[model samples]
Target: MLPLLLLLPLLWGGSLQEYPGYKLQIPELVTVQEGLCVIVFCEFFYPWHVSFTTDQLCIYWYWTGDNTYSNRLVATNCQNLVVKTETQGRFHLLGDPKTNNCSLSIRDARKSDTGIYEFRVWGQYVQYSYRTQLNLQVTDLTEKADIHILEPLQSGSPTNLTCSLPGSCDGGRPLTFSWMGDALNMLDPSTLQSSVLTLTPRPQDHGTYLTCQVKRRWPQVTTERTIRLNVSYPPQMLGSSCSWEAEGVHCSCFAQAWPAPFLHWWIGDRLVEGNSSDASFSVTSSSIGPWTKSSLSLSMELTSVLRLCCEAWNDHGNQSVTVLLLPGKSASRAEVALGALGGAGTMALLSLCLCLTFFFIVKARRKQAAERPGGMDDEDPVMGTVTWSCRQKPWPESTPAQQSHSGDTPPSREEQDVHYASLSFHGMKPQKSKDEEATSTTEYTEIKTSK
Candidate 1:
């Protein structure tokens, strides 16, 4: 960059003042940095015939005080002050007197040097004093712009960032504003001398450094200010899907959020174990984005169902997705449906057997009632009722009586083998009481044989 002092003429040409008779012109305003050099651009004219040799022409520059000129001589063409005094190293008159250029340059300007300065012309025994006030502010380059955020910044939302220059530094000379880092443009973002940058920041823009610069030609000042943006965003799915990894059944979940989202995995109804051999997993984190993404994979047994789930969350919000490899399948699900059906079938079979047994018992009672003598009524027989055809027992005959009574033989073998019983139906009457009925439910018979 060219020195500010060297550009003073070209930089502030439009503002240089001119006069009538002699036409002494110089920059109307100028400022020099402390410990730096500055130039007061000067040009003057006279009638061509009314020229003076170098000896007859003399040029002197003086510092007029802020309130009044104290005759403080800054530099003169006199060989002594130009080579001997403090002006030897600090001040110079670069413009030649014979050439009618009386530009004065100062080095190492100080705050006390802030005020008006003028050129004293001496030519052909005629001296002219053209007084012009140029306030020189010698300040360090440490002045910085103030950065302010108009509102809280949110991810995917527009925000206004204002860089206000020092209130004391605003000059009629428009201060050029610029941006250096983390911006879409280097030019001023606003119409004013300061800038108001409006942009919609993303989660990726958090912690991004933004630098603003303000430079003024007349003041010869440059100030830079930096600020970091903080952007907040909600958790969201990065890839929005999951699948088995190359090596094992691992699922990776991706999310974007501020302050990094917390992550966990769920399979079936149980929380998944991390970093274990049989379907264990792990979580990795990085600062590439504001959000966090987690991946979980469990080694599934051959009989294991292929359902996976992942949850990504933070203070703002949480999101989850379940990945199902096979339809209607999950880890550790029981076959309850098949078992329920089998139970129902077994109960039905037992009910059928009970019904058959009841039918057989009822049929047997009906048959016994039909076979009974005395021809029972068609009405349902009483369960304890009994009927018999034979009456009481018969008396035995004497041996001699049996031979005379016409017995061809004593008895046949079959007759001898026959058994006799004496039974009385009258004595065996039906009992209606519960105890007697229970006892009589079985049939009873009496028999006597020869033996």
Candidate 2:
């Protein structure tokens, strides 16, 4: 009897939960997935020394949506106690009263099952009621994770992505995240995604799809997010050139790349004017294997001496080609002007000398005719020279003066030029006005001088 009396106190007494004399052993939080089962561990203390039996004791489990700690009846062993229709078969008694356990079991849990669950004991135990509460959360796993990244991913650079369960599941089991379905092997294994995934992208990896799967065994919930990658790579050299136009220079560069690259024309270090950093310039693109063939063009003002370059760039790198056009002209206009002037002056002087010779011969002819036959008026002529007008002709340049055949005697009249003039000229003359015979000789009086 003494031993029984002492053990009775140990049956239900010392407690840190609920009222000072009562104690309860229930986890403060519990989590489970919808259509799954959840067990809440529970044990409570009562005044065993007073008196109690299976028939005299009763246990009740109540739930409340209000966080204010008010009780709403759900399931109970008390006679005529009301149980919510929704929690009918869902709530079960997984514990026995003989072991002082008030644990509750819930099967086929739903999202609406989240709330504060409390335990109540009634019957003969010297108390009005003994109670304690635990928060329970139920999840359905309907929402998917979010993925964010640069629209067009850059190659050779690290990119980060994240995937996590929403905040709705209060006390769910530990979640794990993993990568799947990346045949290119571009995803970094060292970089995991409990909520985060990081990787260095490559050009060849463009159009690859990656999946992030999250799993939680407590509720057996699994969620996933799939992402398609568009990797950007710098331009690869195909061809480039800078050629001269009539009034300007035309430059072009062709390359192969992913995520089409930007191209521009440069003269030394400066970007070409009128052809700037905008898409206003010409561009042609075609899809190849894993890349795009892009061609770009720019036109800028021409310079006497030109050093031109064409450059192409993208997220990854850049390529360039240079062309140099040295300074100088193929032919000069100054020399043509000098040759034309010299030809005009020589023809003018030759005409002046011919007029003087004709005047002297006419005077001599009057004397001979007067001395021979018919009459004539004898007169001395004035020195006023009559300059004959001559039309411009398409003539070739003059040849060197012919040497005096018999140096002592005067040359024949048809021998051409009578005297020399100090005419200064240089270079070949301009072409004639038309394609006529420019070298035709002119007629002059023949002179036979008696030796």
Candidate 3:
């Protein structure tokens, strides 16, 4: 772009300062941002009889004063005149004094350079300094770089972005351009240092920041502009997962795209939307930035297997994934049957063991009774006592003989021998009373005889 200094003379006429034999025209005031450039439009006139040639005429622009020794000589046309070290290259005498134009150009302006400036002209025997002074004001830079996108960024599509400062010129201080932000990491490193950058955007770059920074080399001033990229892309499936929990099937889906896609689920042939439920399945969905996620749960009895489909879409395109979910009831039934068989087998085994224990106990009791001697009374455990009794045999033969002859005779009675015995048993010894003997003695034995 052309510098603003080239157009100053055509746009604005300078203030006129005239005298008896000399006239000068230059702007009364000029303002510029720091690290920028400006031009002072000037014109001067003299009587046509005052002759001068191009070789003899010289122009000088000074800072603050007209004396070359006291003031800073910033720009001059004299071959031997040396400009100030600070403004040597940046200050230039753009207008020719032979044509009566004393215009001045200043570049890479600094705040310290703000002051009044005077213009002067010299010839073989003539020298003059204009009474009209030019006021130059250099203020803090408050301008920023402009960013222009050639086209809307799309995933996998190449595009260009240009950065330029409003008042910058190629003739002024050389500017350094740089791009920054998360989105720039995906671009070529060589392309990041130029005023124009070319890049192919991706879905990951959407909503990320891109910054254009402009740096002026002389003053080291930096200005930047940041923009968020709205990269459009088709829906991309990030992940899908499913699980069985609490006799139900739960599934989740994740996807990314521009314009925040809408999410839907298809259970078998039924379609489900956000927070919507049917007789068989329920769905919940949410969208944040360019990513959309959804969850689905099936609570119905599944006697047959079904397919769960998760789909996402937007203005760009669509993406979907399907997963097969086996019937929940089928697995549960098999597990339940195995558990029932195990429980019944355990109960049967317990009953058999109890029966065997009871039979063994009864047989042991019978064997103990059979082993005891006849007519011997065993002591009762609860009472701790024993009793024994004996009786004689009856006369069987006499009774049969008497049955034939003793119809009229009265029967006679006869006594038979009978014996009785007693025994005592104690599980523990008892203390003797004071009246009892010290030595242990048998207390009693009862016996009876009958014939």
Candidate 4:
């Protein structure tokens, strides 16, 4: 009995009421896609071996904005609440008493199910409540699928395509349908229906892939389907076929398939990736019945000789054709001749400019020489000589012969005088006493002459 007493406290510690009641927890705030399930956790403070049941617990779900419960009640403890028509077969309530967990599973979820959910727990001696909100997001599978083009139809004919759900449609508002591609929403479908997109046969409409998508507005459901178009038409090359005028070495492949076909370019056995210099494609479809054609163009940076391969493909298969860009004998010879002519013409133009520049430079030098003083000799007929006199020194004594020509040719005389004066001015002076008597006699003679 004393041992039992000692163990009493231990037993009580291990018992269910050791702590407060069970607390529910839910970490997930949102879920996506229809028929997806969500779990709400219920944890107890004390570890207890309790029987799991939802008999006394009530769970209710409502959208965030509405005061009343959402149209759909996924699960309830009483099983009396009416299940929403959309969620009828999609939801379940699971409970684990030992773990105190009450979780809800929603099958084929819808956008309408997105909202907050409330849970209420009521027992004989304990009444506890907790709430966890679920943000349900539903996405349509159609939105994720790929759209492609199919080929092999007559050129210049109409083509038709069907876009349907790729997989099973889990019961919900069937996804709404829409189509887009080169036509840019040519077929505007307001509701969810199998859409048939049609285009006329034209070379430009050849390789485009039209896409069809299915989407639901509420509980966002989506699905997708795609079909390639094959509008058979004889291949027509865009731009020019002549090799000399070819803009680039690469070209685009196109076919008018009922659905748009895949376009590709090939050189011999190698595939060509189209770029600015290569051929590319754009597609458009006619509004009338099943005829579509695609235009294929090849471009190259004017090569002398080349061979090109063009191919188009779809899910059914692919078709290829080869075109030989052989230069015509005359055309090839003409191109070579023209290339030589162009080079010669360029060289001639450069030579002419150089010659003109040299001529102008010589003319300018001659004109400058003519304009510069004393730059030319007296004998040079191209320029006239100008004489410059030195003002700082006296003129030299000119010889008799030079003096006779001095007045006629002032420059030569001035030069001779400059040399004589430069030499004589250094040491020459007047004679003294004998000059005095001579001076007096000369003065008397000058006075008599003045009278």
Give candidate 3's whole-model lDDT: 0.66
lDDT (tens digit, per residue) of candidate 3 on 270-388: 66777897776778888887778899887776554455667777777665655544443434546746754765765465557647854775577556557766543342212211111
Model 3: residues with Cα > 4 Å off, grouped in runs = 1-30, 38-135, 142-146, 180-188, 207-211, 222-229, 327-451
lDDT of 1 by residue, 1-451 (tens): 3354333433443554433344667777776555455777778664332353434566777776664536567777766443324345566788677777777777655566677776766655445565444456666645477778989887656777877655432223356676655544434445334477776776556788878887756457787888887777655544424333344344565555676766666665556533333424554434355656565654443242234555555665555544443322222224434543555665465557647855886688688766766545442342232221112111233545455746476665655542222211222332221101011112212111111
RMSD of 3: 36.5
Residue 7, candidate 1: Cα error in Å is: 54
- How well does candidate 3 score on lDDT at residue 435? 14
Best-matching candidate per lDDT: 3
Residue by residue across 256-293, what tens digits does model 4's lDDT show?
33344444544434554433232432222221232223
Q: In angstroms, what RMSD does candidate 4 have relative to the true structure?
A: 37.3
Candidate 2 Cα deviation (angstroms), residue 205: 4.1
Deviation from native of the Cα of residue 45 in model 4, angstroms: 7.9
Roughly what TM-score does model 1 have, to 2 decimal places?
0.37
Q: Write the per-residue lDDT of candidate 2 for residues 306-405, one digit (tens) a residue.
A: 4445455555665544444333322234643454365556556665765786678778766665675333232222211111111222222343343434
Candidate 4, residue 10: lDDT: 48
Regarding TM-score, does 1 or 3 come out ahead? 3
Worst 10 residues of 2 by lDDT: 442-451
What is the number of residue pairs that collide in model 1?
5
Q: Sorted on TM-score, highest at the top, how do the candidates line up? A: 3, 1, 2, 4
